[model samples]
Target: MKDDDTRIKFDSEEELIDYYCSKPHPKAFTPSIVIVMLLCSLVGGIIGMELIVKFGLSTNSSIIGALIAVIVGMLPMKFARKFRNIHTQNLVETAISCATFGAGNVLMVCVSIIWVFNKPEMCTGILIGGVIAFVVDITMMYWLFDTPLMGADEAWPIGIATAETILAAAEMGKKAKLLIGGIAGGIIGTWLGLPMDIIGVCGLGNIFALTAFCIGLIMNGYWPTWFGYSLGDYYVPQGVMVGAGMVGLIQAIILIVRKYKGRSKTETPKEELKTADSTFIEPEESELTVEQENELLGEKDEKTGHIYTRTTKQMTQTFVRGIILYIIGAVIMALIGGIAAEMSEGMLVVWVIYAMAAALISEILVGISAMHSGYFPAMATVIIFLVFGIFIGFPPHALAFLAGYTACTGPAFADMGYDLKAGWILRGRGRHVKFELEGRRQQYYAELFGAAVAVVLVFIFYRSYFLAGRIPPVASVYKATIDAGVNGTVLRQILLFAIVGAVLQLISGLKRQIGILFAAGLLITNPIAGVAGLIFLTFRYFIEKKFGDEGRKNLNVVSAGLIAGAALFSFCTNTFKLVSTNSKKG
Candidate 1:
């Protein structure tokens, strides 16, 4: 037999481990870890529901609670790190992260509904319904599917989790059981095992696990059949459907043109040297050491000095550039918020336009700048939500916000997919693997399930409370605020400024015009108070642009600090108000 050492061309054992550790593993978790993470998720869900009920679903409450949860959950892991082996550490960290995401998602849904309905008492019934559903689903899955698939590899855990949840619901003779099972399976599968597998390999593997889990749930009647294909019912208005179709046709034409050009080039055998351009580039390959190879092949990369690799300078540069674009995009959004506050009527139209424009501008900027990508765009979208909600007012219906969020997240998700692919390539994972497609499918199904569940609960609660004359004052209070007008002039000015800024950006080729637009918009809204905004914008531009590399870095950090500080202040102030109100009532 050929020598084992000579058979594999690895630089070192450490290299083999490192490479293997970076690739996706089909079976990354033991049964115990899965159980623990699922339990953590249940706990997180309970805590999240309690907070949502107590605090109401205001922006401040959501942010503060999420922040606290993340900090508390992560801090313990740092100390426990010393005792953990590599796999254990990954499992623990991944579990925490998954739990955090799940908790936030649950909290947001509850709070969003309350905000929409403006009812505090309604929270009790909905909370009870949601929790009962979740618990029942989890219990059923654990008893049936989880036990049988305790040591199953590949997609079996997901299949079992999903199957058991569905089967349990069927046995109970409850349609809601299907929903509960799906949600429970999704949360446990993605948050616990999926993350470990993805992180253990190159993050790309998570997509597969997530996909399998979602598919399993769907097969068990946990997901809606229409799913993402229901775009027409949700998004497209009858009148505008034709226009949307035209846009798709145009895009298809462009795609065909590109494809035809490529085919022509390939058909024409070029004897001449082809210059590197956007259309063509040399194939780049990454050379991995023995540890990296081993990791890709489903081994572990011990944190030896020789095994671990530092993040590349190019990646650092990309991150920095992305951050800069994100900040600029945020400032623009803030200005829009101020303007939207000024609009008296047709606010929805104005809001929709602003959202669409912001999405387009952010995408264009990120696309033009090679260093930046979807990360900055995602940040901008979230900032836009914050600015609009606080300065103008949160949207009455979740649909509008959901539409904008979907638009923004689409590109961001694509960017994340590409980033994972890069990691997979670097770690020597299979090239043919289509994990992102699976992730997308999973997200679609999850959203469908969530929406369906929410709709049913909302209807039930509305009938039970409002139609039956047990209505609370929450809706009335919200309506009264809307009638009184919550700083409409500010929103109008912000919108005007964004329009002016966009026009200037298109015509003048001057990026500073954005700052000018913001300053002028704020000034128009409140002349005396707006000076501070002007000063800040001016100082930021001059200090950052004129200074050396160190100066630019300092300014960037300072700007980020300012945004973070303001957000923190707003959150604390809002929480204090809620507490004071509760105290007074008590």
Candidate 2:
């Protein structure tokens, strides 16, 4: 082997720092990122709770509500001309939004527990738990604040600061201090929230959103300390109220701090400031080459006489196409959900059908976006959820929630595509995006790998003198619902009809709506589901026209973020459960 010194090279300190700053790392600023994610979980929890209480929704509705809130929150940024200009600032904002969503979800869980138990004191316990969680999260964030990984970028500081504010608010016992902390947390949260929002809305599936929610749940004392003491068993209504109150306190403090800090910060040098205003500086003329400018504007090189500019009209056309696809996809999704709900006797089958449909929809959208603009995939996914939710007897608010959540996935998937495209655009290493795609393809296989490894490990442990029989299969909400007998036959029939319709449409070259109608006829036995389908269809018709050109551009990032956040949240939650279970047993 070559000597170890052979691989070593020296560089100037400045050069090394510049190099380090330019590169992204898996673990860099991870703690800050985790904190920001926790905050997002809190927000999600809170939104989930509010939906349940205000709208009298279920878990499904709460999820949908959070999804809707995320989409609504993302809209302003989507339309703003300056949104993309400040990438770092956007990153910070998105992080904050994610944190808020997470916080909301936690609050929702607490409230739900309270409602279930019908105990007033449970609220107090929840409040204490929330405070404790906030303190732990914030303290950990602060402790890791000065690490080089957290200091290398503008986004990191904002994320860290937001977490810090949340900690401060939770720890502050005085009413005034608590008020101040809440205000500060909100402002900072808002500031840091945008990036995550963007990611959640525009990305196809969010890995972060779910992960953050799960982590926050654990940190906030939602995860059961004992296997037999599951979260569902121990959660009380009072605990939820107290948690909400604590959250409110933190939000107030954050807002107050922001208000006071705003005055003094205005006097600082413009260059030194790290607000959204300062971060999104316009790109200089030098940054764009003649070729790049032509590419961006769809202009052509004079000598080559090739037109490179993609007109606003062309972009609009692409947007319209995406919307159309989305509508069609939605119809298909609704039909599937309805059929599954109707046909299967087993609840597990229903969930499996739903997951399969979602996975298929996601994959199809991804493929379609690859062939066109990135927005189509996410739009398609959202439309699918909305159409199905309404058509299959979901409540109006539930439909709205589904629409929002589904819509969010569009952006998440689009982002994955965009990231791939960015690699193409920037001539970066080809492996990053390619690897990502491959990873997605092999995800199921990876689970199998993990299972196999786990089995082997268990066998080894048993043989090595540890007292062990076979590990029991892990129980989950899905399993419980399955046991409850949620049927999927109706949903399956609907999906089959949809497939038939699509096939017919392809063969006869008929309008796509014909396929939707066919699927609807076969699957939608419930009036509620039918109403949802009609509502979404009507909305799609108007909005499709209204969006014209703007929606096309806006849909890409926003939808990507939504999807990414949802997926992230789900994945994280599952991972947490796995970790907790495994850790406990070990």
Candidate 3:
């Protein structure tokens, strides 16, 4: 509506260039963002580590965590127009990097699976594997992801969503108010879930941690029967999952009814028809064609759908440099791995090399998948890596490490690439960091630093929780499964579904999140939640039709808050568990 609004509504990359180039952005990473990032990083690490340890799931909808971090991080710059979008972009970058920020997911999954090998404790050997992953992942992120991100056309859906959220945060509109409300709601929700016994009275049933509450509700006479059938032995998850879905469905149906019911009052006859005219929601793909974007990049993509790619010579150099850095990093890792192993069995060197080789192959496969489809079969890749490890005749410790570490490190490169992809689109002023890294962007350092912080904090928590006698049974289950490989688990069937999921993504060009839901629907005994999501989104389409961006932003804010609140509670509960148990032991 305003001159600034006109500029901000970028229709193409040229518009982006005009808007960004018009501004002489003075500051890089503003101080307010930095301070908030530190807090976010700490919280993210704690929560992220705790999730894998306790629940084996991180924030599936990453936007929730990103929004939570932004709210908690006090992203004051995003609200102030004086600060460039690039600065805000950097803030989002740090927030996201710090938030899930660790290879912790891999470590938790790996260690938990093979806890049998270590028996009473987690293998220190795997810590070395984590170290190897952390270093190699970082190296790839710093040296290689810039190129990958530059070329890919995948939606990078979460990254784009975060960027859009950041954009919304900057707007002095209802969007900002909704985001503020979401933050407040999330905080309140988290407070309500605080421990009554331990933290004194706020402890209550949580929406996310529904297992105990779900069963308790059933066992405590909430429902003894359903439709003339006895439910006493029907399993509580069935009811809980059903209740969760119904709750979602009720909200959606109400919203849809309200929208169409009210629409008649606001719409003129002509306007109603105009609104009903055919509308195509843009695919979450490039706004510019490859040819058009080339005009902006000063480099044409000889290959279709890829942009800003390196020449063959440049690609070769990047490869050589990446490998050289990897080899050096591997040496440091081998030493740490040997230490973690507490013996020179030579598996450390072998596993590191194995990880590198697997990661390289995965980087191409998964990276391409993420770049073009926003769907990388991370679990499938890990399965393959584990199979490779099985062939290598790795001991339980090394086997678990190889599979999990490969899974973690390769996808990390993809994650960084997506973050950078968003950054590239937003156009960060690539500030020189050091003489040795003269051309590097400050955000790259920020990402690298985040990587280091996340690894340290998560590993510390991982060790601390283990010391406090938290043996994540899920990981132990994985370990048991790994021991037998195909003979041990139902993984072959799951992998089949996962591969089908990948193919669906490839063929339909659906987002990875959808594929994930599809996979879960196939494998899990419970799929009521997915059904609820589908119902909610179906309702959401009508809401968007009625209210557009304002409606969506509002929905995202409330949803993000609800989801993030649950995550906060989970983290705090886990952290308290470790602290209290450790104190008792002391």
TM-score of each: 0.31, 0.24, 0.57
Ranking by TM-score: 3, 1, 2
Single out the weakest 10-residue window by summed lDDT for candidate 1. 145-154
Worst 10 residues of 2 by lDDT: 145-154
Q: Put down candidate 1 lDDT per residue, 1-586, tens digits, no spaces.
A: 1223212233432344243344433222345444443444344333332233344322212122223323333345543322122222223322332232223323234223444454444444333333332222222221111011110111221112222222222123332244343344333433342321111111111222222222222322311354544211221111121222223223423533443455434222111212211211122126444433322221111221111111122223333443344333323432332333434447655554444444433332322111111011222233333344445454543222322222232222222222222222222222212221222223223222322333343444433333444332323333333334335564554454454334433332221222222211221222222333334434545665688675643433233223223333444455566568658969
Specify the highest-TM-score model's number. 3
Candidate 1's C-alpha runs over 4 A off are 1-19, 22-30, 46-95, 105-494, 500-586
What would you estimate as the lDDT of candidate 3? 0.45
Candidate 3: where are CA atoms >4 Å away? 1-33, 60-86, 92-96, 107-116, 119-125, 139-152, 173-306, 309-353, 363-380, 428-440, 472-474, 485-586
Q: Work out how many backbone clashes candidate 3 has.
A: 7
Better of 1 and 2 by TM-score: 1
Provide backbone clash counts, one per model. Answer: 37, 148, 7
Error of 3 at 331 (Å): 5.9
User: TM-score for model 1?
Assistant: 0.31
Q: After superposition, how far is residue 217 of candidate 3 from its true place, in Å?
A: 28
User: Global lDDT of each model?
Assistant: 0.30, 0.29, 0.45
TM-score of 3: 0.57
